[model samples]
Target: MRVDTVGAVFDALADPNRRTLIGFLAQRDTATATELAAELPLTRQGIAKHLATLKEAGLVRRRRSGRETRYKLTPEPMTDAIAWMATVGGQWDDRLEALRSHLARGEH
Candidate 1:
C-alpha cells in the first residue's frame, strides 16, 4: 500500500467506533448504514460518516443495491499494515535478544 493509504488506514482505525464498525462488517460481510445504525448507539448519519471514512481508508468497499448502499470489509490493504507491524515486532525482538545476551555475558 502507499504511505498515504497506510496513514489513512491507521487514522480510520484509530476511532473506536470505526473499529467496531469494521468488526461488525467482518462478521456480516456486508451491511447498510441503517442496519448498522440500528445495532449501534450512533445515528444513521453518524454511521454513514464513519463508513465514508472507512471507504476513504480503503478498509471498506461500498456497493449500491437499488436504493440501498452497503459496505463490506476489504482485507487486502490490511495485509500490508500487518506485514509492517510484523517487521517492527521482529526488530524489537532482535534488540531485546541482543540486550539479553549482553546482560548474560556481563553476569559471567
Candidate 2:
C-alpha cells in the first residue's frame, strides 16, 4: 500500500468512535448510519462523519440500498497496514539484535 494510504488508515483508527464503528461493521455484512448510531452514543450525523473518514481511508465501503446507504468493512487497506507494521517491526528486531551483539563484543 502507499504510505499515505496507510497513514490515512492510522488516522481514521486514531479516534475511539471510529474504532467503535469499525467494530460494529465487522460484526455485520452491512449497516446504515442510523443502525450504527443506535448502537453507539453518537447521533446519526456523527456516525456518518466517522464513516466518511473510514471510506476515505479505504477501510469501509458504502452502497445505496433503496433510501439508505449501507456501509461495510473493506479490510484490504487494513491488511496492507498490518504488513507495513510487520516490516517495520522486523527491522527494529534486527537492529536490536545487532545492538545486543555489539554490546556483547564490548563495543561502544
Candidate 3:
C-alpha cells in the first residue's frame, strides 16, 4: 500500500470514536449510521461523516442495503498499521535490552 493511504488509515483511527467503530465492525461485520450512533455519543449524521472519512482513508468499505448503507472494517489497512507499530516497539525493546546490558556491566 502507498504511504499516504497507510497514514490516512492511522489518522482515521487516531480518534477514539473511529477506533470503536472499527472494532465493532470487526466483530459485527457491518453497521448502519443509526446503529453506530446508538453505540456512540455522537449523532447519526456524525457517525455517517466519520464513516465517509474512514471509507476515504481505505480503512472501511461499505455496501448499500436498500436505503441504508452499512459499513465494515477493512482489516488489511489495520494489519499494515499494526505491523508498523510492532516494528517501532521492537526497536524500543532492543534499545532497552542494550541499556540493561550496559548497566549490568557497570555493576560487575
Candidate 4:
C-alpha cells in the first residue's frame, strides 16, 4: 500500500469512536450501523458517518441485507497496520538498546 493509504488507516484508528467500532466488529463477524450506535454514545447517523470514513480507508466493509446495511472489519488493511507498527517498533527497540549500552558504559 502507499504511504498515504497507510496514513489513512492510522487516521481512521485515531478516533476513539472509530477504534471502538473496529474492536466491536473485530469481535463479531459483522454488525449493522444501528446495532453499533446503540452501544455507543453517538446516534445511528453519526455511526454511519464513521463507517463511511472507515470504508474509505479500507478498514471496514458494508453490505446490504434487505433494508439494512451491515458493516464488517477487513483484516487485510489491519494486517498492514500491524506491519507498520512492527517496523516502527524495531527502530525504537534498536535505539533503546543503543541507549542502554551507552548508559552501561557510563556506569562502569
Question: How many residue pairs collide in each prediction?
Answer: 0, 0, 0, 0
Best by TM-score: 2
What is the RMSD of candidate 3? Answer: 2.4
Model 2 lDDT tens row, 1-108:
688999999999999999999999999999999999999999999999999999999999999999989999998999989999999999999999999999999998
List ranges where model 1 is wrong by over 4 Å: none
Which 10-residue window in model 3 sums to the lowest lDDT? 1-10
Please write out the lDDT profile of model 1 over residues 1-101, one tens digit for every residue. Answer: 46677778899999999999999998997899999999999999999999999999899999999999989999977877887778889999999999999
Estimate the overall C-alpha local distance difference test score of candidate 3.
Answer: 0.85
Residue 65 accuracy (lDDT) in model 2: 90
TM-score of 3: 0.81
- Where is model 4 poorest over a 10-residue stretch in terms of lDDT? 1-10
Error of 1 at 26 (Å): 0.9
- Pick by lDDT: which candidate is best? 2
Q: lDDT score, residue 26, model 4?
A: 86
Tens-digit lDDT string for candidate 4 (1-108): 466778889999899999988988988888999999888899999999999999999999999999999898988887887888899899999999999999989964
Model 3 regions lying over 4 Å from their true place: 1-3
